[model samples]
Target: MKKTRFHNKYKLIILGVIILLTGCFGLIYFFYRQSPARGEESGDMVAGVSAGALSNTSFIKTYHLRDTTHGYGLFPTKDGGYLVTGDTIAGGGMAAPYPYIVKTDAKGGKVWSRDFSSQSGALGYLSNRHLGRLAVETSDGSFVTASDVIDFVDENLKEIYGDVLLTKLNKNGAQLWSLMLGDHNIDRPRQIWALPNGEVMLLARFLKTGYSSEITDGIPEYSVFIKIDKNGKVQFSKKMEWNATGAERLVDGGFIVLANIAVILPKPAENIVGPEVVPHPLPTMIKLDSDLNIVWAKSMEMIPTEMNSPTSYAGGVMTVGKTIIREAGGDFRVIQAAPDGGFVAFGYDNLILTQGMSSGGAINISDKDVSLRPLVAVKVGANGNYQWAKKLTVNLVSGGSANDFHVVRTADGNFVIMKDVAHDALGVLAAASAVNIGLIKTDADLNPLWVKQYSVERSVEGYGLWPTVDKGVVVAGSMQTTKMHYVMGTSEPYTEAALIKVDVNGDVGGCAAVTTHTGATLEDQSSYLVMQDMKVMGSENLTLKINKKVKEKVNNAKSAARDICKYKKSNVTPIYSLLTSSDGSSPTASGQTVVPSTAKTWAVINYENAKEVAVVGEKNQVIHAELLPILNQVYNSQVKMKDSMASMWLAYVFPRPVTRADVEVIQKNLEGLGYKITGSEGGDLWVSKIGLTLHLEFAIQNSMMGKLEVRF
Candidate 1:
């Protein structure tokens, strides 16, 4: 007796037929396609263990993300977070500069990272700046770093070009100030430090006039240490004829200076003997008084041995040394410098150069810049006597590829270092044989108090350092599931984000590292190492389900073409109404039934129906939804029974849990041509209405729109 909308638009019998078909399709789909989609991600683990390395040097935990940026100018913060500066891979000019900064929690997990130089490549804008050394903390709790800018312009702002870009960031990663260093290629900063008198000093290299062209410095390079007030006013500045690599403020408020001298050996002497002539690294050191006057200067002797690049700083000197590194098993020197001059001190073992076939230049000499070398830490006593010496190996040597550490003395009078390790190698190799960082805490005596190592899953090495904090050691990494079962194949390789927390004991622990955004389709290799977290942002099951439905739709058409092809006039187009997994676990679900939205599909045999194309297609979809309750036999469910497609439509719905057994059965059933099945519900299946001239699918989402189309 109820006057339905279909009643007003069609004859009573046809309207009844429409409602009945809708009910039948709905029932058919309910029992077939439709299952919940959800699961957890796993990790791959290798053999081995070392409790207190740097990071996961331990073999237990396998956590790590593949797409995180390696932190440059790494520093740990007070609140247990890290503040790093680097450029996004997308904007990075390879060796060129494109400035950006990232802030991560104490655990090396990113809170957020932003690129200030996204426009570095826009129009005429060709370059930006990369961060150098970090200076002292400001009165307001923020800190500053020195760097150089190039062809930079801030729209609506006045300044541009090679200015010294001084930036101050808060504990929460907010930018508070940006001070430019130069107007053009004339000036640039090499190092920076904080003064107790509310002033900041920068140690930088400057070029005389006319050096602005791509590569020429008229009067060679002079190093300048500049002092500026909190307001950016230049209070005093000094220039050293030679180039300085860095500058730092000593504990006593004085400054430490790092300089570089090109040790030219007059290659002609070497060329006399062979085709190749080897070059070497020189030693450079300078001591500047408060007024930026050069108090003392010195140069290190040519080590004549392997010299690794290890950066060092003290009251009036900055040093860099080398050690046995990477695959190159050779002892390197420990170079140092001070106010009076430089010391080409020797450390590590010693390099042994075996005679090789004659090749000239670049080959014989061992130096810092060319190899993966050992890292050295140096501290000079007030009286100039060396106070202490230390060298880290094992995890520090080969592991340097993955785990780098930051050494700092904590307020508690204890010293702690942070490192990273790769833990998942599937026993193919020992975790230690790969990469891992370790945090070794020692007493003021430098005696090992406790050691904790953290390891991650991926990265032949492991997750790069995030940041370090107080309390325990904070770190972050990522992980993923290995290959799918033996033969079923894999839909995708998924990954998740993780943050690791360690107690003083270095026991297995946890923290907050939400892995909400983690998947990305690899469309372009150029964009492989993305700076942002991965782009996988949807349900994993949804992907397979949509694909499954499409396959089902395809399966049905092929079957119809084959089944009735003998009928000659029988159209071979497939019709889709229900969904089923080829493996049968059609109605996939855990708790709530996660299923695809309901809809219908059909092919137009004639274009006339094409005008009604949109409408005609929708009717079948509604019928499919309507029949869900009926074919599944839910009487109380809202559905009108219709035998309209009874002639060609055969309904099948998965009622219970659609398991592996079900998948096998369904694959066999749909083996012939023209059989289309959809698991509207994960793990569930539903057959399509018969005789569709075109193949299509039913897709529904957050909105109320339903149409015959491919499942996305």
Candidate 2:
């Protein structure tokens, strides 16, 4: 009996020892799951994370015709297509210069093309230069274009005079009617606007008398604003003293005109043979009512001028400088309606020419003596009051001109300026003579966010720019190419219409490297200008035909210079896989605890923690079971996981707020374990490998919770 009691005591001792060890392990797991494991190495836990492939729809396309073709205007249609207008030589010859219009689908595939050569033949001209520079789609689903048609030709088929032509076309590329406006001289339409009431407004430059009657030397050009009905009848014709460079219709049935007025500066007394007056072009803004009545006129003040020669003159006034015959030349090329019912004008300024006379009474001036300034953007309020002006500093070539600058306001209240610049200007290493199209993105206040240059082997001249629905931009222009020309005896470079589409980041697919530039801005100044109104007559209806034609598509991707000009890849972060049951069973299997049916797996990563936690699925359970022990060992803390029927989602609560560094540590650990970082934005990161995707959402505020979602 004593021996049996001793054995029971030994059994009790052994039971006490087993209980103590069980309590120790439970305590270890409890502390491991409770402690935050941020910044701890994830080791092999993320090795199997993976994602699916991604796709994009960016492209670079060039349209080829029989002869030379130029792209002048590009507009997005309501059907997600594009309309391009310019001049093209027909029948592979220069004798058939016609105003050309081509429509393309969203992917830059040519849908249809039309030329005005057949219609212009009604004017009894077989060989004339017709240029369709601008076109806009009306609310009635029709299209209208403003062009310049050579009216008179010499014996050698040379253009003698030009007339403004307005042609309206149906949606199917059929011409409805045409109108011609001219004064038996040079009349070129600069801009056109479609009215809400089925009417159209046109701004044209008319060659007229000189600005000054006393010193009548050079023929001065004036701007004419004409409103015409849908039936090709003129409604109102109002003429202005200045030449309109840009114009747009306002929302309140008003109009804003950006023009340049030639301020005549008196010639110095020392010059007896030269002209009596020097014409200096100044940028002016004019506001007019719907009836074409001028409301207010403001001009950019003459920038401070430094005399390079002996004489300097500006704003018709001579400064403390010698006969440096200073001639300021610049004009605002484009304007757009602002968000606040205002207007923004963009142009280049400070183009000065200084002329000095030698002791032998000979003029000494060359093109090299010209001084060019950076591009400028000016903003004005609805009341015609000057708000702000900014100078866009760019590295411009010494003798090169940047007259073909275009600007378009984005949907986000920002502005984008497209201009031609040397490759070096954009920090691109290329030939000294290489030129590229530069795009500058600016904020609402004209502060440049970034600058990018697009180029090929030859030069690129961008003429049209339009913002895309994806907050990107579509640029249409001409690119030069060297081809064999039998008539030229040697291979010569010709231009073809080119279209390039890029995303907001200015990144092109297949081209990993992009040259970026840091653009600077400066405060600018402006003043006011005097305005005068005049009257003009209407035009006669003309017969014109828009003949359907076909244009060849040059595969930019197969071109030899394809490596130089790249297209955009995918701009969106792709989601890899969807949730599914690993055992191929129904998601609503009996006895399975499933998440709420209305729960969204991919929710926006806000600061607030998820209201309902997610449960782990069968596939995630395996990974969860393997990951917890590994994480527990690495972090010296216990890791816990939730289970569900739909998918696997693990929420890790940190004792302190999550930090960028902590997130970086976790990302690095996953990358080291063979997981690829597919994308990262803000505080969220996506990691994938094989068939698994791990979306790590780190909330840096509030509870500072980090949620890791596993999907297969």
Candidate No. with top lDDT: 2
For residues 463-516, what per-residue lDDT tens digits would candidate 1 score against the true structure? 323222323443433333332222134343233223344443444433211111
lDDT of 2 by residue, 532-613 (tens): 2212222222222111121211111111122234444474532211122222222222122212112111111121222343
At residue 479, what lDDT does model 2 achieve? 70
What's the lDDT for candidate 1?
0.34
**Worst lDDT window (10 residues) for model 2?**
37-46
Q: Which stretches of candidate 2 lie over 4 Å from their true place?
A: 1-57, 90-96, 118-132, 152-159, 209-219, 262-281, 303-331, 351-373, 395-400, 424-434, 482-485, 510-514, 519-569, 572-712
Lowest summed lDDT across 10 adjacent residues in model 1 is found at: 552-561
TM-score for each model: 0.40, 0.56
